[model samples]
Structure formats: structure tokens, C-alpha cells
Target: MCRLAMKTASKPFSPFSVLEAMEAMQEGYDGSGLGLLLRGLEFAEYKYNAKDPILSGIAHSEAALARLNKIMIEAGFELKYDHEFDVKRQMIEAKDRFKYILRVYKQSATWASLSAEEVENRLMLTRLALRKDGEAHGQDLTVFSLWPDVAMIKEVGWPLGVGQALGLDSGRITSRICMAQGRQNTNYGINLYACHPFFIQGVATMTNGENTAFIPIKDWLSGRGFPGYIGYQSDSEVFAHILHYVTKQLKLPLETYKHVITPLKNEELAAHPQGDFLRGLRDACRRLIIDGPNAVIGTLPDETSMLVMDAKKMRPATVGGKPGEWAIASEMCGVDAMIPDRDRSKDFQPMREHTVIIPPDRQELQIWSQFDHLPIHQAA
Candidate 1:
């Protein structure tokens, strides 16, 4: 009964309450340019004022462009107020505006002198785009990735002076923002239907005392369920590359893996199943390698088998995939990305893999999922 109560206590007041809170907080900090807190808040208000979602979203988006200009001034970038972002119809239709913005940042937007405010904007944008885990979620179900780099800030002249915010990549940052904002104005990381955003299991990261590295796993994190332990393999980059290559040797796409590993539609998965075998599960992934689908087939223990069985059904372009929940970081010294692949593929040649499908609206979900599982104190 105490265990049941514990679970009940963990439930949210209402499904949308988390989103409301997130949006409210976001709206409360409206600033332009590097002050993403400010811009996000204003953007939230713009959405709240709308009568129609489609139009409201557009309104908020237009305001973002306007805010981009304001941010330029606030950051003291080379933009001038008499500026113009010559968004061509064809270019807009293609939905690739980052290059265009960078090409004309100074000429197409507002200009000003750098200030603490610009530094502030740069930092905010950088943090939003660089973090390893998702920050926004809905009822802690649909977790998604936020930054893979920093196009949104770069396009607008990288408001955050801190190296373009989130590790120096234009496309990565834009993808992060686009994912978080989605099609609606304020999804704000709430899991509505126990779907993708509510849960996922892939590469994640954590720092070690001496170095940083990746922990690979056929992770089953989310509203979904699978049997296994959380394991550590190597440093982050090496782990990422191997899993990618193994998925290629097999025919599974990443989405298919997500669906199976952290499924929503699969009736086969039973939530909160009986078991206290977590410690054993966690220890299983210590340095496991994938040699190829055929060779890797029977090598794993039951936990590994379960993870691989599901992952194999819907895999990505990877050669070495561990079975568990783990994250990877670049600084893990005991690891190198390429050799793991070499070992995994030495026995066999890699074959083509399926493609993964990524939608634009899953960012808020990813951010939310990252913290939902934490203890209240950890969350804070």
C-alpha cells in the first residue's frame, strides 16, 4: 500500500498543469535577443492572446522575428534598425532560413553596441541549445532532444556572445528551437497521450571525476516499458558512433527503435511490472559490444536480449548498441568512437540501415521528460 501511495503521490495535479506552469514561467521572463527568457515569455504572451491557433502561432512567430531584431540591438551586433530580413517566398517555402540570416545578419537586421545584455542573451541561447538532456516535458511522459547545436541564435546573430550558444552549430540550435516550439504556441513539455515526447531511451550523458564519455543503451525510458538495467559503456562520442553504425548493419530506424524500446502503442508493454532486479540490470551493460546482428543475436543476457530484440525490430545505422538506459559525453578518456565500430564490424561488413523520422514538435516533450523522473529536490 505504501508503494502504491508513493506512485499516486508522484502523479501530477492535472495533465496540463505542468504545461501551464512552464508557459507561465516562460511568459514571465520576456526579453529579446540573448534574453531568451524575455523573448520566450513574450512569445508565450503572444500565443495566449491569439483567438485561432494557426494565426496565433504565426503571430508569435512574427514576433520572434521582430524580437530577433530587438535582440540584435540589445546584443550590439552589426545590425541596423532600418534593417530588413529579405525572406524570399521560395526560401521560406523551403523552410531553411538560417543560412540566409547568417549571410545578411548585419545588413538585414538591427545593429548596436555589445552589452551585458548581449552577453546575457548569448548565454541564455547557449544554455537552451547546449544541454545534453531535454528540459521541457508534459506530465513527464514525452521526452525529446533540444540541442544537437545553435542555428536559431546564429541566424539572429548569435545573441549570446558565448560561442554561438550550445556548442557552435547553426543547424543544431535551429533544430532545437523548432523542436521545442513545435506547431502550437505553448506545448511547453507536457505529455498528453503517453507518446514519444513523454519518453525515450537513447544515448544520454553524465560527468566522471576524471573524464566525460557516452553511455550507450537500448534504453527504455518514457511512458513505455522494457526489461533491462541502466548501463555504462564508454565515453559519449564513441558510444554515439557505434550505436549509429550498428543500427545501419541492421535495418531498424531510430523511430522504430524508440517505438519498441519506449513504446506507447504497443499493448505488449506492461507499465510498472513486478520486479526489484534493478541492480542486476544496471550492471549488465558494462562494456558490451555489438559484433553484428547475426553474431550479436545470442550474446546478450536476458536483459540484453530483450533490449536488442526490440531494438533490432526498428533499428538505426549503428554497429554496437548496449541494452540499458545511459548517456554519453565527449570527455570520457577511456573511450574512442571509431575503434568500437571497428571491433563491432571486424567480423562482418556493415549493411544499409533504415532512416529515422523526427518531427518538429517533440522538443517541449523532451525537455519535460528530462526532469520528470527526478526526485523533487533533484528536479529543483
Candidate 2:
């Protein structure tokens, strides 16, 4: 599907209506909410314009929070503080729910008000609990037999088709091909395929991001010898290209295999050979290609399908058949960090780059909630 045009400041942003304002009040960080807060803070005479207004707006903020809580409660929430509930707690809750308004308003207002360094510094300070990580996924990976006989691949004209198939821009799709492969960010998804079908002897390391066809070659395959495409770093391009045909285009059955695994000392190596290892590696990729999409059902989907639950079907947060209200943390990651014995990230792989976060629902009201609760102590 074509992506919606992202709102930019160069063109006039349409003025938001009352309905938009009400929705922003509910969501906390919508365009209207940002507009309201931007006009409020940008025109403020207060020294710490950001914080002071929240205290000034607290009465309205409290009313908003009360309504949200009441909805949650009527929806069947058993509200109580886990530790102790202070009035400050409500302010913090509302502030957090709508923190993005502050961010969007900042952007809409301008960097002219802030130093370059201050802008950079503000990112970390503002979103304390946001989890920063990176993830990768793919669609319709297919493979073919290249074990004994080498397979030949043909480069088809500009893979705009591939881009559409995988939900990416045609321009981005075009840049990847026939260019120096670079990283959009280490966090981006990449795609690579064969320029020409040639001999396949060893592992293929394909890449896509800054470029369409560069792969990183490590000396791990020393004995494999200098093979085809002497200019490329890794053979992943060849491999992934082959996979595109075998798994996606042809839907061929592939013999999945692993190329290498450690712990193959005299003891472990005694049971397995080099060929067995490669097969294991291939099988692993195949399984992931098959299962990854299903796993992201609740997290992300290629297509957005709003499962509008019947108003009566959805219930408030519950436990043991009791209505239990939930406290969403500073961010989704924070909530994830709260599960029992959940030192979830301690041993987990740190992302090579920061992860991106997008919310499913409009959150402007949540941001407005924060403005309502900005603390007097934080007042400048």
C-alpha cells in the first residue's frame, strides 16, 4: 500500500477542528493537541513556559485524568496504588500518557528556541523509560538446490515489484540496486539478490539498505577461496537472491542447513561434519522465514487491521476475574521491564542501533495530560 504523506511544516498544516481537539484530548499527542500546546507554550510569558502551564492547566488535566480513569474503572478497573497514590501520581500518569505532545509541539514550534546541543541532549532526558533496540524481519523467502549443481540467477529490471511486494518505497528500492551499499541506519531492513546466477559454493551474505548488492566478507570462509563477484565483501547477496526465487517466487521446498556452529571441539566435531553444519544453518533461516510473520501478529503487521472489538466484548484490565486497572509505564518497554524476575535486557543482545517506536493509537490527549500535570517544582 502507498504510504500516507507525512505532515511537514513547509506546507501549511491544516488547522485542527473541535472534534480534532477532543480526539487530541483523548489521545494526548495528536496534531491538534500539539497545535494547542504549541500555541499555549510558545506564546507563554512564563520563564519555564513548558512546566508552568502544566500547573496552570492542572485543573483541566485532573479532569481529563479523572475521566480516563473513570472510563477504565467503569470498564471494570479496580484502581489502587501499588505503593502509595499521591496527587502527584495523577499528574505524572497524565503527563506520561501525553508526553509526545511536548515533542511534537517542540518540533512544530522550532529548533530556533533551542540550541543544537540542547536539542540533542533533550532526547534522552525526556523519554527516560523508552527502550532503545533494533529488530529485523523478512517476507516470503524461498530457496533452491545448489548443493551439487551451481544455479544461475538473472537480474530482472528495477525491482519495484520487490519493493511493492515487501512494502517499501520504489525510490528506496531503486537506490539499493547498482550502487555502493550503505546503511540507512544499522536498524533498517535490507534486501539483496543475485545480479547474475553463477556458481554457488560457499555461504552467500546478501545486504540491502544503503545499497542493493554489497555484502560483508569475513575470513571465516578462508578455505572456500576467492569466489565470484570479487568486488563484493560478502556473499549474502547471492544467497538472499537465491532465497528470493526459491522461497518467494517459486515457492520451492528448500533443504535448510546451518553453515557453522561452535562447540565443535574434538567432542562435538566427532558427531558432525562440515556439510552437516551448513545444512543446519540453511534450515534455520527457512524456519524463521516461515514463522516470523505469524509471531508479529500483535506487535506489527504488514497490513493494519483494526480489530474493533465489540464495545461489550472488551473488558478493563482484569486478574483472577477481578477488574484490575493497569499503569502503563513511561514507555511500553518499561511495562515489559516490570514482569516477575524480568531483567529482560540484562543478557539480551543490545541493538547495534536505536530502535524506532510508533504507537497504534493517537496519543495527543496523553501529551496534553502531561501539560496539565507539569510540576511546580519543575517550574522555572
TM per candidate: 0.21, 0.17
Clashes of each: 74, 50
Question: What value of lDDT does candidate 1 attain over all alpha carbons?
Answer: 0.20
Error of 1 at 276 (Å): 12
Error of 2 at 73 (Å): 73
Best by TM-score: 1
lDDT for 48 in candidate 2 is 28
Local accuracy of candidate 2 as per-residue lDDT tens digits, 1-380: 00000111111122122112122223211121010111111211213223211110111233343443343334232322111101223322123221111111112134348774454334322221111100011211112111111111111112222222222221211100011111112222322222211112211221211222222222322223423222222233333333323323333322211111111234433344343443344443332222100000001111110100111221111001001111111122322322223333321211111111112231111111111221222121
User: What tens digits encode model 1's per-residue C-alpha lDDT throughout 5-63?
Assistant: 00001111211211222232232222111211000111211222111110000111343
Worst 10 residues of 2 by lDDT: 291-300
TM-score of 2: 0.17
Score candidate 2 by lDDT: 0.20
